[model samples]
Target: MMIGELFDPQAPLAISEHYRPHWSQAGAIVFITFRTADSIPYEVLQRWEREKNEWIARNTGRNADWRKVLPELDPRLRHQFKKTFNRLREDFLDTCNGKCVLRQPDFASIVADSLSHFDGKRYRLGDFIVMPNHVHLLASFPSEETMIGQCDSWLHYTAWKINQQLGNKGKFWQQEPFDHLVRSPEQYQYLCNYIRDNGTKANLRSGDFLYRQHDNHQ
Candidate 1:
């Protein structure tokens, strides 16, 4: 199927819901963010969890329409559901919670290697940055198989290797990652900027952050 058709808004999407709903579309450009296990503060996470539950309560069931649901929701609730997520993410990431293991040069290199290991093999990687507590990436998956399998592989392998290096067997990352489909050129550029500026925004030192993008070299 054509990438555009695969991501048609009207087309039925295979969504996996845990704390947040994950939309999977074959052959789509995606922006993904995943964080270390303790990246979010406990109080912030508790509030986020409560808000997510409330959102699910408002937008549950198979027949619910996203387009209409937002319009119908209370203005304040809609703002939380639609608007504040970015702020929330930025706030949490800025907190720099957890061990900040990626601050270590070796650990950060492992993550960078893991992210680049499948470039051009599983997906066409555009831009990515490894932050101290979290990572952001923009890439295009060539197929459903590549999207599902390779994403899991990257995360699993990185967590395992990082854990081995840290000598801790506990969870290395948060289970759920944030993913958004990039459907337009404008949105694509926005994500590129987001990834590029993440380190600066988070006040990361040069050695603590690794950023690579196709546009910069070319």
Candidate 2:
């Protein structure tokens, strides 16, 4: 039932960049979202990426290093950018794109089990849901490395198992997941509510998605 601590702005933060930048704070609760590789259409993703790059260039100047530009933005502007970026993608996810194999109870169960495997030992598991084509969860890791490593472990294991079940090959998950450190109690509760309500918002029927929340919180 440990929700962990909120992020401290003064504390040292870790920034990891791949296709996008990920910010991590040791011991702070984080909300994460990862989707199937085919969840978003290629054209749609390409367009989104183009628009994002354009926005970055307009705001931070042409060819500005995203790694530095993002972290250096005004807090309000950064929040605005992130909110819009996430919202557009989330709206598309709600359309239930891709094969949505996870809609099957058996496939979804594999992911739920993988996420719970190391619960308290490696990181504190919080509210999580296995959606049709994506997953959303909250957890706190002992260190920034643990957070990144655990996310990879979960993605790798679940993808392998699920792919084996389907006799399919190749990538199962999108390489980079979207993650954010919990900034305050309000934001933590907001994420909890978001997880709880995602299925309904996506119009997924009962048994089409798997949702779990701590009993203490409910």
Candidate 3:
């Protein structure tokens, strides 16, 4: 979408730094991360996921198309479906977990499921890796809709599943997430490497991605 537009070199900053309004120019691969409040470890998320998967197996006949699974159910359930996702993010976490944020592996299953469910929809997924404490996503904004909107839906759907298992309410992810606009092939390659490596290049323990950054060549 931002193919020919000029990019502002001064827009990217960590949350510890002041917030600024900037997304990478069109056709750029942005590396983004969102951590739980207080930087809790994301590793413990797996401990809570098995229960949720078991519930789905019992209720949904083991496996079913996600888009078709719930809309036909009770109206309240439909409401829950819509309520779980967030635009810039999905959940708010309690800081009691640990120092390192634990990444939920369940989210990978959820991401695959949702992507399949929305296959024909107007969305494009770049590269992504779910770590114990954070996520690295390299996605392209669909020209048909807002990038944040699509991201919100995916996150909410996953969070909804988690919430259903936990039987608790409130936020699951921070409201603000880091986003970047890719401006050059170099930057795109840099982010693609980072996402695939999921910060491993910097000694960060995450799922190694190693995906091709071909989107940059386009």
The whole-model lDDT of each prediction reads: 0.73, 0.88, 0.47
Q: TM-scores across all candidates?
A: 0.79, 0.91, 0.51
Worst 10 residues of 3 by lDDT: 87-96
Relative to the unseen true structure, what is the C-alpha lDDT of residue 87 in candidate 2, on a scale of 0 to 100?
95
TM-score of 2: 0.91
Candidate 2 backbone clash number: 0
Model 3, TM vs. native = 0.51
The number of the candidate with the highest TM-score is: 2
User: How many clashing pairs in candidate 1?
Assistant: 0
lDDT digits (tens) for residues 139-218 of candidate 3: 55433134555556756775677567657566665545676555676676666665565445435434422223334344
Which stretch of 10 consecutive residues in model 2 shows the poorest summed lDDT? Answer: 15-24
| Residue 126 accuracy (lDDT) in model 2 | 94
**Which candidate order results from sorting by TM-score in descending order?**
2, 1, 3
lDDT of candidate 1 over 79-101, digit per residue (tens): 66755666777767966788888
